[model samples]
Target: MPEIKRQHGKQLFLITNTKQNCAFYRKNKFQQFSHKIHLLNRQPLENWSFVRTLS
Candidate 1:
């Protein structure tokens, strides 16, 4: 992820499927960017978007 930041000079973005994972990301310094409902395997699921600024 750091490599991408070095190349693009932008923040890193990620989507995680569970709140627990989101909390983990938060603990690691990633901020919540947004939330969305996603369809997976014919089921609807909630996902969290997180971003870590590398610039």
Candidate 2:
């Protein structure tokens, strides 16, 4: 889990690279406001990339 600094409020975001969800978004996927989905081709202006990492 990670906290994204936004102008509105603090947004809790996560990156999911499950193979089952590959068709969902080719690049990045995120949520906005409540349960809305935000599919992004590139990453936002932040200190993170939309790449998968071993945890």
Candidate 3:
């Protein structure tokens, strides 16, 4: 029936939307994690250089 088809289409759309949202969130989380790692790496290098300068 046409009504059944409409319902099926709506469900499919919802499923795809959720999938896209999940992928977007995963990418954001990865970027945040990499940024944190970059900051951590830079901090140690900066400190080492500062210590070397002092010595």
Candidate 4:
């Protein structure tokens, strides 16, 4: 796990979805390093890998 940041209860928000965003990190892997992965407002889930969001 990443370095301990803020801890409240059993709930933990450590490094949300690092595996999803590649290149965002210097390293090629996600472990111990803490980071925030942005969620796509829109995504290409069908034939494309691009991210797209719908309102």
Residues 1-55 of candidate 4: C-alpha lDDT, one tens digit per residue: 2222233232222332434453443243323433333446664232112221111
**Which candidate has the top score in lDDT?**
1
Clashing pairs in 1: none
How close is every model to the real structure, measured as TM-score? 0.69, 0.20, 0.22, 0.17
Instruction: Please list the Cα RMSD from the true structure of every candidate, rounded to 1 decimal place.
Output: 2.4, 12.4, 21.5, 12.7
Deviation from native of the Cα of residue 52 in model 3, angstroms: 37
The models' CA-based lDDT, in order, is 0.86, 0.36, 0.28, 0.32
- Lowest-lDDT window of 10 residues in candidate 4? 46-55
Q: Which parts of model 2 have CA positions greater than 4 angstroms off?
A: 1-14, 27-55
The superposed Cα distance between candidate 3 and the true structure at residue 4, in angstroms, equals: 43
**lDDT digits (tens) for residues 1-55 of candidate 3:** 3564555532211112233454554443321111111256455211110000110
| Candidate 2: tens digits of C-alpha lDDT, residues 1-55 | 2322333344334444343444343344432222234456764322221332322
Clashing pairs in 3: none
Preferred candidate (lDDT higher): 2 or 3: 2
The total of clashing pairs for model 4 equals 4
Off by over 4 Å in 4: 1-4, 8-20, 26-55
Cα lDDT tens digits, model 1, 1-55, are 7678668867777898888898789998899989999788989999899988876
